[model samples]
Target: MNLAESLGDCEFQSVNTAYDENMPVDRKVLVDNATLSGVERLIGESRVRNLGNVDNDILCLEKLLTAILFSDALMAIDDYKEEYRSKRSRQFSFIKFLKLDHVSYADLSGKAADFARSMTFSFDGSKPAGDVVSFFEALRIDPQLRWDVFVSSEYLTMSLLVRDTRDVGYENSIDGVFRNESANADVVLAGIKFDAPVSMEHHAEISSIKDLVDAFASNNPNFRGSSSGSLLARCIFGYGWAAERSYFYNAVAAQNNASVFLAPLRDAFCEGCCRLESRSQVESLLAALKSKSQATMAKIVESSGQAKFALKLPFFSAYLISICDNPRQCIEHALELRNRSEFRDCRSILHNLDFLSVGERSAELNRILGLLEQSCDSLLRKYGVATANGLQVSLSLGLAGISAGTSIKLDRLFPFYRNRPFSRLFRNIAQDMVNVERLGGLYEKLCASVKEHQDAGYPSRTSVTPKFMERRENEYGRPAKL
Candidate 1:
């Protein structure tokens, strides 16, 4: 008979099912001898039920009965296994109730065993609120069903399952089964090479940055000759202390063949160090620098990007010389050396130094400033300096005021100066500066006010007097001063 007909003929009688005390008792008791026999008959029939022909109520009854019977079968298989283990029973009660012969029982046992095991393992003494195990069992039973869903969902399920079973002994078995059934099994399995644990013997041998870089390059050959490789190399070198000065030098020198990669390597090293901002790292770098000979130190300072890294930090230049035996000699030596003839590089270093000295100044600051200034002067002399993008560089004279002529000259020379406004505003400033008479009168007024303040007998400078007066009278007469 069809599933609906069989379900329609069944009579369900309330029967109490034994459950662990810890298990929830919210489930309705809907299964009995008559209902179980009806389900068995429905399973035995191979005929497919036509939902269009079947009544909706009978179809619903069929679905409800099927679900209840499936859940009961899952729980019974788990109980039978436990009972068989303890008592060595020759026959399971559910097996006899279903009237399954040897072959049928073996087939049913194999089909339902995994779900039973997973439910028992996951829930332990209590039943789970939902049958998560059955859902996974459906996926295992039907390959086409897994293919219909998004691949990422499968990966998410695998991750969640792994996390849930991490401390359990059966995680590996579950992981192996899921991976074997996954659509991307080849890709997932290939990643195992990278995830393999590093051997202690090999790990112990990575005593220097060079050793670490070599090991990485050996394993990830595809990443070689790429910017990513350079970045990785820089991180290795920058984040750790070297075993010796030679080791550090050799690591830097090895990348000379791909000099184009050096810029990013240097930049990343500097950035990594700055981001860490660790006092211990700073001290380590300083100690490394101090141990080297003057010639070796100069190579590192001038050629290997260490000088730029050190200058990026606040007051590090001052700090470096502070710990030196001869501060004056060190300053003089640094000043005498010539930097690489790159205008942009010189400009960047000078800007960093200026930013560091803001809000405070010292003799050391002046000395460092002189060293960079001398390098810049030397660069300009050698290259015959030109305006950066046709704009003049603006100069700040502290006591001496910025004149209109100076502004015009700066606009002409350093058109690319950061302070230069957009084209429209720049044109307005240039036009205003050209009106020399107006600007001159304003300047004269400013000078007159300054002279008046200096001549006043008040203890402090005051722009306003204590009493108000008519403009004409105030201009001509000496008003009451504060």
Candidate 2:
């Protein structure tokens, strides 16, 4: 049995919440207390705003019921075959978990019963008290969840996003929010790529997102990037190590003081009610706000896309508004959009469909390629990238992930620029800086070779990656040692 169950002796029920006797009621749950977020915030929303259509709510509830997973705990025990991710920390007990797309509840009957109970709450948009109980019980007995505990400090993959605090908070998934230290912990996830939040002056890219997130997760000692990120975001999310809300005690900007606004945010909260008078106090207030905000966010998620799409522009824009303000919202938006049959359409037809008649396919591909060339010309002029002797190089490269030389002539008008397509391929791979530089630098020499086809087009053609050449040489006897 998991440690959470070992402490208690009663038979665990999936649909009934057994209140923890260790939990104190008179004391505030946020101030120097264990952060307990109820699954109700996510599962209990339909009763209050029965205002929305039941069809959509039913769909979303079903989606969330099966989709959400706690990967960290499953991995630590090492018995669960399900994919798992965890966080490394200074606070000792803080952990984060992620459930990927492949896993699901092996016992569907219990899950459906629990979710049905959660949907029948009293609040207009209530929390799922019963749902939390079910989740904990199910996790305790599930073969994957009941695996052995981890002896080493190795954390999970995507779940590296948790705080490093141990004294005041413990990682509890049934609560619907992760609890970790706020003092100085940092949690980061690698490999999950994201584009920067859209902004002016700074061109945000996916690699930049990965790097920034890694820096926060690594908590400085493990982080190796040169850039600095918004410290407030990390602290707000309780991803910092050694820093609890109490650390804000000495700062005038104590997050709870309610009087410490910088004029702009002065009106965000009532005067003196949300001021941060000290560092520890600031931590306390922010931690509280984050706790509350977590619930509100879950509520919003429950009501997500419940309304019908009457007007396309306003509907899409409003949906994007929710997503733009928060990263989780962004993910949910993408998921929702994917489920909509209405928005799917053919984006462009330029790639190879070799089985079709060559003449007709060639004509269609050429027409599409022509349009791309025109667009590239415009982008270069607008973005202030001067077009030299050839066409706008970047845009012509266009759609990513096909082999690098698939469209060599699309970006270059010169019959002599045979290697241009290869160059464009590398440049189009936004996250791939290495190949882009290597390809960009070799373009001129390749172009010259293209012009003097007899002088050494062979070397230009042969100058591919060593990895590919290795495979090729394995087949065709190591070609004259380059």
Candidate 3:
């Protein structure tokens, strides 16, 4: 954020001159992206030319806060690395001016100062690497804050980034700003972590700040201890839910000295080739694999690439049988595809639990039957025949979401459209096709039309076929047609 904006937001005096005038500005840091660069050019030139240096002031505050943040991260790393490289302890320094009228560290005392002291522990004896962020994140997981203690309403908002192993406390106040405790610098940043690691049985836990804290403190050891760092990192790599997981990804990689953080991403660069019929399709899939739930997709990939391919044999066969409809082959495919675990949802199985023995056969039948029932319901619902009232409306929605020009039930279509309602058509043809007797030709005709239309593009989509309607007044044995 620029100066004027932060001042207006924090309700503080807008301008204060720092004599650090000529230290070749950290060009890369200042000009992060085009937007930040623009802010710099506009603000810097303004301050130099004395045209109301608004942006410069906010940016400076942001810079200072970023310093603090760097200090925190470096300290955490130092704790983990234990390299005693720098002698200066990265303690947060207060702005000389936020010192007016007991504003600086002086204004803070008694309960408030004690509370703040009690709030954060200055790097517990253990390495902060994963533990410190977890502590701050524990503070952040309060799904919400009822900050009656805060002087300004702006402090009300805060977010926590928690991975099983790595985490951080981020404030999204008036402007985009994040602070690393040790650096005492303000970074107008977006995120911290970037890529997640690949591992089995990894899951991210997203909950309210209160819930997060509760989980960390109560029962969810993964959120509290350093042990959680790797687990949380793995989950963050998967689908870390709180805020955006991407923000914490890079930050965690840069700071936390844990088990190789970006090993999966590097490994992918080394060995991420996926062979598929469509190269473009595979590339796109691989791209998605980066952000997808890695563990779940891994299961699918493992099954797909297996030597025997037994795990997915059932689904493959079922898919082929759906298109071909060769009953014998479909049965064989269905048998191979079926898994008892897959049919635990079938109400039929739940009902006949005692009589029908549980096995692949039962699961297979239930799977097909379950699919059939669902498909029928889906088709019926699509055609607006979901309810009894809709049933009489006839089939306006056809085979593949198409609509016949006109619709009529079976009895109406046969003799009506052909000028020979089924009442008459049946009398003439019932003697011929024995199959039609068992399932009347009119019924047979309906089924045939349904199948044909399903395949065709009006009632057939690609083809135009006349829809049937009921007719009367002239036919052999026309049974007093209505």
Best by TM-score: 2
Q: After best superposition, candidate 2 residue 81: deviation in angstroms? A: 9.2
Candidate number with greatest lDDT:
1
Q: lDDT of each prediction vs. the true structure?
A: 0.22, 0.20, 0.20
Cα-based TM-score, every candidate:
0.16, 0.17, 0.14
User: How much does each candidate deviate from the true structure in C-alpha RMSD?
Assistant: 43.5, 31.6, 37.4
True lDDT of residue 211, candidate 1: 48
Candidate 2 TM-score, C-alpha based: 0.17
Give the lDDT of residue 354 in candidate 2.
12
Tens-place lDDT per residue, model 3, 327-437, is 223223333322222222222221221122223233333333233233223322322211221121110000111111222211111111222100000000011111112
Ranking of all candidate structures by their lDDT, best first: 1, 3, 2
**Deviation (Å) of 29 in candidate 1:** 85
Worst 10 residues of 1 by lDDT: 422-431
> Which segments of model 1 are wrong by more than 4 Å?
1-263, 278-365, 377-482
